[model samples]
Target chain A: MSTLLECKGLFKSYSGRPALKNVNLAIESGHIVGLLGPNGSGKTTLIKLINGLLTPTQGELYINQNPVGVESKKIVSYLPDHTYLDMNLKVRDIISYFMDFYEDFDEKKAYDMLSKLRINPGDKLNTMSKGTKEKVQLILVMSRRAKLYVLDEPIAGVDPAARDYILDIILSNYEEDATILISTHLIADIENILDQVIFLKHGEISLISSVDDIRSGQGKSVDALFREVFRC
Target chain B: MLGKYMKHEFKETGKLMIPLNLVILVFTLLGMVMLGSRLLSTPAMALIGIASLTLYILTLFAIFIVVYVYFTVRFYKTMYQSQGYLTHTLPLSTGSIVNTKVFVSLFWVTVTVVFTTLSIIALVYTAMGQEWGKMAVDSDISFLKELLFSFLLPCFSLTILGCLEQLLMIYASLAIGQLFRQYRVLASIGTFFVFYIALQILGTLTMFFTQFFSMDRLFHISENISGDSFIPFYRQLFSVSTIEVIVFCIVFYILCYWLTDKKLNLE
Candidate 1:
């Protein structure tokens, strides 16, 4: 598999405080990777940098060997941690909106997912429960045939059952050659599904290893190892 | 892509604008009916007339406030707030995004101004009947033609240019303000006032310098001057302001696009 993402000495700072500092990493295709970190560990900041929401203070980051830009945005499907959909729009309107901007958007698949979730297409976003809105956003992001999926804390807000459903949807919907980078702190819940795990601490990547390697070498689960490494 | 962006922008803004426009139309018609007719003999009719007129005026005021506030708020909310997660991720150039917004905003503002002007004209036409038309036709033909061609048309164009300049100034201010980590909204408001004051000072300096250099003499004609001289004089005056407005628009647009593309700091 070829490399899908590269960050060389990636550094981002806000008000002279470092959010991500001297981070170098590469992601290859066809694997689900967990970007595990505690709160304020620069997980979301890294995700936003990938999505072009914030410019880097120094260094370089690239997607598919191309620098972060409109072209990179075209091939990356991103789901932010917060509710980003316009509240005044209905579910159907937002679907159309996604379809209009993303040429790779699958309208039929999106509608099918909405139906499975028992979400009416005509329901206004403001009226939907927070979980339902998150589901809608996930469905939209997953419906795109993108080369990279950058999901920031995708399963954080949903219930356990809904989390399973979301994981299932994510696991089943992406292309075979695409890479998934899921940023979350719920390591135990998603450890089984992640082929590789990256542990971030204090604006730096402390560990990057395959799940099987961590289990075999450390003789413990990834979550247990994470607790050992990042324990206060 | 710009077309798609503009289409969505229009749809979103139209939801608020269409209803407001309808209200304006309905109230304008009601006012015409109340004022144009002679149904004010009784105290009740007189009170109704006054109430309807007041409502009509208030609705007109609401149209202006609502449209301006809606566009400004929509720009801030969609581009800087949570919705920015969706907006900035789109596979389009920042220029296209900013241009689509500026165009749609200008479109709606123009519609509101035109609608308000037409509503007032209609009201006056209803009240004056044929007298207004006869008076317009009986005026000095050469003078009327000169006024329309030299003054009114230039003023109309300048009004539009000025509107675009102001809208872009707001956009640039918001873009600069979002770079702040805290007090982003307050920063944006401060940026706007700073830009406003700077522009005011620049305008005053320009006017002062022009007067100092006796540029106004170009437009000051003797009372005995012929009608043909009016066109050249007005054209010169209009060109200076037009060029200035265009420059401001370009500068503001570049600032907005650069800040959005290079220095985006979305929350």
Candidate 2:
């Protein structure tokens, strides 16, 4: 499969302090890549750059060999760490909103998933718990048939059951040929499902390897390696 | 897309305005009742004073609504804050998002203006014991035109200003907010303070320029003009220059679009 996203020597800084420094990475289709990083390690910033939310201070970011812009947005589905749906909006309203804007949004698939999850179409978002809201957001993101799915901390701040459900929903809904780049600090829960792992430290890629390679060659799980590498 | 934006805008604005509208209605009703009881008073000035006071109160309410509309327009920018990540990540261009807000803000302000005008007219009729329609007919043609123009022009100008100012604020807020990742509230507050200070400085400079231009001989039309005459100055201030106002409004809208489309930072 072709590379869906390519970042070369990417650099981003906020208020003259570096958030990301010369980060290099490439993502291909048909793989779930884990973007592992601690807090303030520039995982969100890198995701924002890839999704065209933030312009890079320097270096290049490309989706399908083209620079990030409106075209990139069309192919990228982003799930932010925070809730992005208005509290006043119902589940159906948000679905319709996505449908109106995104040509590739699968309304039927979203509805099916929502119904299976017991999320009512008429339920107001404000009335739902944070975990439910996160589920609804995940449903919206997973419903898209974009080439790249950038999920930033999709399972953060949720109960164990909800986290499992979120992971299951993502696994079930992702298109087979598309790329899912999930950024999270919860290494162990997701380490099993991730096909490839990219460990980010101090705003740079410290390691990138396939899960199988890490397991067979190193004789250790990605989580254990992560703890060893990132140990204080 | 436009319809959906407007529907949400109306719903959001309704949350804040429903109570304010109720208050305005209550005060208007009270004014009518008080005016009706005092109709037989010996002093005519008392009745006129009461009528004028009622109208002034209604005007004040209208101003509040206009101001409310301004903030409502601003709220649309942040309305998606809890969800801005989703909104900015949508396939739609940023231009559409801002346009949706402008249309809805204009719609609500227009609605409020119409209601305020109707309530003020009702208060006038109730307080004066005169048929508003008949009095409107008897009122001088120029006076009526001036009145209509004054009310309508300001409402239109305010709507345009609401659109432009809020768009600028949204862009500025988004750009500045991205500087602080987790603590976005601090960034917003810091940006607001910066914007406020800049606005004050700009206002002062504009006032200075206005004063400078007024002193220029070419700027004054009447060479022998009497500064003592308040009527002519008042008439000029409320002049019904529809064409000029429309052009200015178009310019303001273009500026809003330019700022939002080119300068917005969703990060």
Candidate 3:
């Protein structure tokens, strides 16, 4: 596997306050990596840096060996932790928007996912429930034939059933050559799916290890390790 | 991609803008019929006619205010608010996005200005019944043509430029406000006020500079001997104002583009 994402001394600060310290990371293609961290651990900042939403204060980041830019954004699909979709647009209009903007977007797959969830294509986003909105966002992200998917807190606000369905969709939709980087605190629900996990604490990387090594060598699940490592 | 961005922008903003403009035209038509047709000749109906006229004026103001505010708010929300997530992540350059928003808004503003001018002309022509021309130009077609070319057309262009300048000022202010970690909206408002004050200073300085250069010639126009005097002073004034506004527009646009392209911090 080749390195699809690499960060060298990546750092970000807000208003002179550091949110991410100098850090280094590299992830291979085709792996579902869990960015495990508690609140204020800079997971979102790192994700933002990768997505080019926030400029790094100090270091370098590259995706597919390209710097973060329009070229990088073209191959990276992102789902933010908020209601970031245009609330004024209907689902079909948003689908059209995505199809117009992203070359890798699959209109048929988007519609299929919408139908599976029983969501009307004509429904406005502002009229949808929060859980339904989250599901719609996930569908939009997963429908793209992107090289990398950065999802921030994808299942944090959804119900258990919707979370499971979301995980299923993520697993079923991703291609073998693509990578998924999911940032969340609900480690147990997603532990079984992650090939690797990077634990962040207080704006710094505390640990980065494969799930198999943690399970087979330490004989403890990632969730149990997380509980023990992050116990206050 | 720029074409696509502009097409999407027009579709999104046109739905409401088209109806509002049509309503203004409809009200103008109704006003012309009421005032010019003598439809409200009765005593009580005359009072209703006055109220109708008042309503038409209010409607005009409302449309203008709504257009400017909607454009400003749309820019802020789409570029800085939560929806910015999708906007900033697009595979298009930041310059294209800025261009799409500015040019589309300028197009709509120009349309509104044209419609407003037409409505005013229609209402005045119907109400005054050839008297406006008699009073303003004494039925001299050449003078009227001169007014159109020299004054009215230049005035319209200046009006459009003024709108663009104000819009860019707001954009720059909002861009600068992104530096604040909290209360960004309030910071935007405060920055706008500061920009307004700075503009007033620029205006005052221009006035003083012109006065200082002209001495008493700024107000006193005594020389009536020459056929050619620097293409008329009014034309010169218009040219200066146009250049000033264009400069401000460029500065603000660059500030907005630089801040958005290099220093974007959508949290």
Predicted model with the maximum lDDT: 3
- The backbone clash count of each candidate, in order, is 0, 1, 0
In the range B1-267, model 1's lDDT, one tens digit per residue, is 888888888887888888887876776787678667767658999897778667777888877887777878889998989998899999988888898999999998888777787788888788776898898888888788888878888888888888899899889888988999999889989999999999899888866665566555544656536767656766766787788889989999999999999989874
| Model 3 spans with C-alpha error above 4 angstroms | B40-45, B132-142, B216-231
Give me candidate 2's TM-score against the actual structure: 0.77
Model 1, A11-51: lDDT tens digits are: 99998999998999999999899999999999999999999
lDDT at position A182, candidate 1:
98
Task: Give model 3's docking category.
Answer: high
- What tens digits encode model 2's per-residue C-alpha lDDT throughout A1-232? 7988899999988668888999888888999999998888889989888876666888998998888766788888888888767788889988987887788899999999989999999999999988888888899989998888899998888888988888899998888899999999999988988999998999988999999999999999999999999898
TM-score per model for chain B alone? Answer: 0.87, 0.58, 0.91
Could you arrange the candidates by lDDT from highest to lowest? Answer: 3, 1, 2
lDDT of 3 at A166: 94
- DockQ, all models: 0.86, 0.49, 0.88
**Model 3 clashing residue pairs (backbone):** none
The stretch of ten residues in a row with the least summed lDDT in candidate 1 chain A is A154-163
Candidate with top DockQ is: 3
Q: lDDT of each structure?
A: 0.88, 0.73, 0.89
Q: What is the TM-score of chain B in candidate 1?
A: 0.87
